[model samples]
Target: MIIEELRDLIERHVRPDMSTPVEGVMIARDEVSTLEASMSGTVMALVAQGRKRLALGDRVYEYGPGQYLVSSLDLPVTGQFLDAGPDRPALGFGMLLDPAAIAELLLQGGAAAMPDGRGTPPSGIMVSEAPVQLLDAVLRLLRLFDRPRDLAMLAPLIKREILWWLIVGEQGATVRQLGLAGSNLSRIAQAVRWIREHYAKTFHVEDVADICGMSPSAFYRNFQAATAMSPIQFQKQMRLQEARLLLAASPNDVAGVGYRVGYDSPSQFSREYRRQFGTSPSQDALQLRGGELSLAAGLA
Candidate 1:
C-alpha cells in the first residue's frame, strides 16, 4: 500500500530534529501526545498514520491517513494527535508553502489555471483529501532522501510537482490565490503580517484597513473570513502564544512576563492565559520544565 510505504519511509528517515536533507521538508511522529497551542505558518501537512486534530478560532479540523491540512496564513492554533501509541504512532509529512514557486507554476500554466471570478474567497486554513496524484508526488519527494546524488538535481522538480498537484486539488482556488499578488488572500496576508509585527500595540481598525487598501468593514469581514478571528482576537492570540514562550523560559516571573507582553494587569493576563491554554501560566511553565509538555508541539 502506498500509505504503508510512505509511513515506512518516514520512520526510516525522520530525525528527532524533524529535518531532512531536503530543505523546508519535515516529518513528525508522536505517541499519545497532549493538545498544544501554537502558531502555524503557510504549510501543507499530510498524515500517513493515525489521526490528528487542530482547532482554529471556533473551527475544529480532524484528519487521518489519505488526508492533508493546509494552513495558508500564519495563525495561532491548537493541535494534537487524537490517536496514537508506541505501536502505532501518529506520523505526518510537512512542507513549507512557497508563493514564489506557486507563482512560477501559475505563469508556466498561464492564466487559465487561475481561479475564476466566481470562485469562493480563500480561507486561511483548509483540509482536503489527498488525491492519488498528490500522494504519488509526495512519495516521490520523500524517496529523494535515499538518493543523495539525485537529490540536488531532482528535489526541486519534484517539489514543484507536489505544489502543482495541490494547486489543482479540491481546494485549488485557495492555493491559487496564495500566489496571486492582487488576490484578496494576498491583500489580507499583508494585513496579517502587520498585525503580527505589531501584536503588542493597540491599533485602530481603520489604520489596518488602510494598510490593506480596504474599508474597515471589508477588512474586518475579510480578516475574519480568512483567519476565523477578529483583529483584536488575533492580536490576543499572538500575545498569549508569545507569553507562553516567555513563561517557559522564565517560569518565576509571571507578572513580569504578562506586563512585557502588553497585559495591563497580572490577573487579566492569568485569566486569558488560562482561557487560551486551559492552565495558568505558572503551571504550564512548570509542565514545560518537567517535560510533561513538548515545546516542539507548537512548531512544525
Candidate 2:
C-alpha cells in the first residue's frame, strides 16, 4: 500500500529528465525493456514499482517493489527494467549518497557504526529489502515536493533521516565505509574515480595503487572484490560504454569513434564492441539512429 502510494507520487512528479525540485532526489519512469549502459555514481535507487535488472561484470542483480539498491562506488553499469511497459511503466526513487552526510552520521554514532570487524570487502553495490521506517521517511520526504516553501527548511532533515535508516539497515557496512577515510572500499573508491577519469590511457596498477594508499597486491584484490572486475576489465567496459554513447550520436563514424575512445586498431575496436554489446559498431549505431536507446534506469 505504501509502495502504491509511492508509485502514484512518482508518476505524478516524474519528469522526462528524471530531476526533481528537491536537490539530490530523482524519480525514474521507464517504458522499455532495452538494457542501458552508463556509470553508477554512488546512489540509492529504491524501486517503488516494477523491477530493475542490472548487470556488472558477470554479476546480475534484479529487484522489485519494496526493495532498494545502493552503489558506493562509481562503476560501469548496464541494466534495464525487466517488467516495464507503456501502460504500467517501472517507477523508482533515486538519491545520491553524500559521503559528508554519512560521515556525519558515522561520527555521531561513534563505534557501533564504525565497527572494526569488517570482514570480506563489500561489493561497490548492494540491494536489500526496505523496512517500513525507511519507506515512510522517503514518503514524507517526497511529500515535501508539493510544498516548495517548506522544502529548503525541512528537506535536509528528512534526507538525513533516510540516511540514518540506511546507515543502520542491512547494507549498513557498505554505507558506513562509504564515509570512512581509510577503509578498503574508500581506497578503492579513489581508484574507481581515477580509472574512470583516465579510462583510455595506459597506466600501471602499482601507480594507481600508490595513489589509493594501497600496495599493488592489496589494491588489486580489493578492487576486484569490490567491482567484480579486474582493473583491465573495468577499463575495457568504460571504453566500450563511451564508444556506444558516441555511436548513438554519430552513427556513421564508427572507426573515428573507436579511435577517439583510445582504441588504436579499428579491427580490435570492432571485435571488442561486438563482444561487449553483441553487435558491430555500425549496426548498433543504425539502431540508435532509428530511435533505439538503452534507457539505463532513468536516473542513471
Candidate 3:
C-alpha cells in the first residue's frame, strides 16, 4: 500500500520540471527518456515505479521500485529511466541531503550513531532497497502537499525522520560522513568546491590539496575514491557540462561557448563534446533546443 500511495502522490505532484511545492523535495514522472549527463549532489532518491540507471565514472548503479539511492557528495553522473512511458510513467521522489540536519541528529544520537573511523572514505554514491520505515516517512511527508497549513508545521519533522532512517540504514557509514565535520568526505567536499568554483582556471593539485588540509597524495587518492575521476578529469567534465548548459541558451555560438567554458581549441572542444554526448556541439545544441535533451532534472 505504501508503494501504491507513494506512486499516486508522485504522479499527482509530477511537473514538467519535477519541482514541488515542498522545498528540498521532488517528484518525477517520465515517459521514458534517453541517457542524460548531469551532476549529482548530496541527496536521497527513491523509486515507487519503473527502473532507473546511473553511471558515475566507471561504476554503474540501477534501482527499481522500492529501492533508493544516496549520493554523499556532488559528482558527475549520467542517468536515465529504463522503463515506463505514457500508460505507466516512472515515478520517484528525491530529497536533498542537509548536513546540518544530519549533524543535529548525530548530536542527539552521539557516538553510537557515528560510523567507525574514516578509513578510506566511502564512494560518493550508493544504492539500497528502501526499508518500510523510510518509505512510510516519505509517504507521510508527501501527504502534506494537500495540507498546506500542516506542511510548514510538519514537513521538516518528517524530513528529519526520513534522514534518520538513512543514517542508520545499510549505507549508514556513507550517510554519516556527510555530517561529520573534518571527515574525509567533508575535506574532499572542500576540494570539490574549490575545483567547481575555479574549474575554468588552472590549479596544481598540491595547492588544492593544501586548501583541503590534505597532502597531495592523500588528496588525489581520496578524491579519486570519492568522485571516481582524477582531478583533471573532474575539471574536464565540469567544462563539458557547463558548455552544454551554455549551448542550450545560445546554440549558435559553439566556439564562444567552448572557449568560455575553458577550452582553448574549438576543434578539441568539439571533439571532446562529441565523445562525451555522442553528438557534435551544433547537433546537441539543436537537440537541446528542439527539446530532445534536457539537463534540468537528475538524481541530484
Residues 92-115 of candidate 2 have per-residue lDDT tens digits of: 999999989998888888845357
TM-score of 3: 0.95
User: Could you tell me the TM-score of candidate 1?
Assistant: 0.96
Global lDDT of model 1: 0.85
Worst 10 residues of 2 by lDDT: 111-120
Clashes per candidate, residues 3 or more apart or on different chains:
0, 0, 0
Every model's Cα RMSD, please? 1.6, 1.5, 1.5
Error of 2 at 4 (Å): 1.4
Q: Is candidate 1 or candidate 3 better by lDDT?
A: 3
True-vs-predicted CA distance for residue 42, candidate 2, Å: 0.8
What's model 2's overall lDDT? 0.87
Reference-based TM-score, model 2 = 0.96
Q: Per-residue alpha-carbon lDDT of model 1 for 129-151, expressed as tens digits?
A: 99999999999989988999999
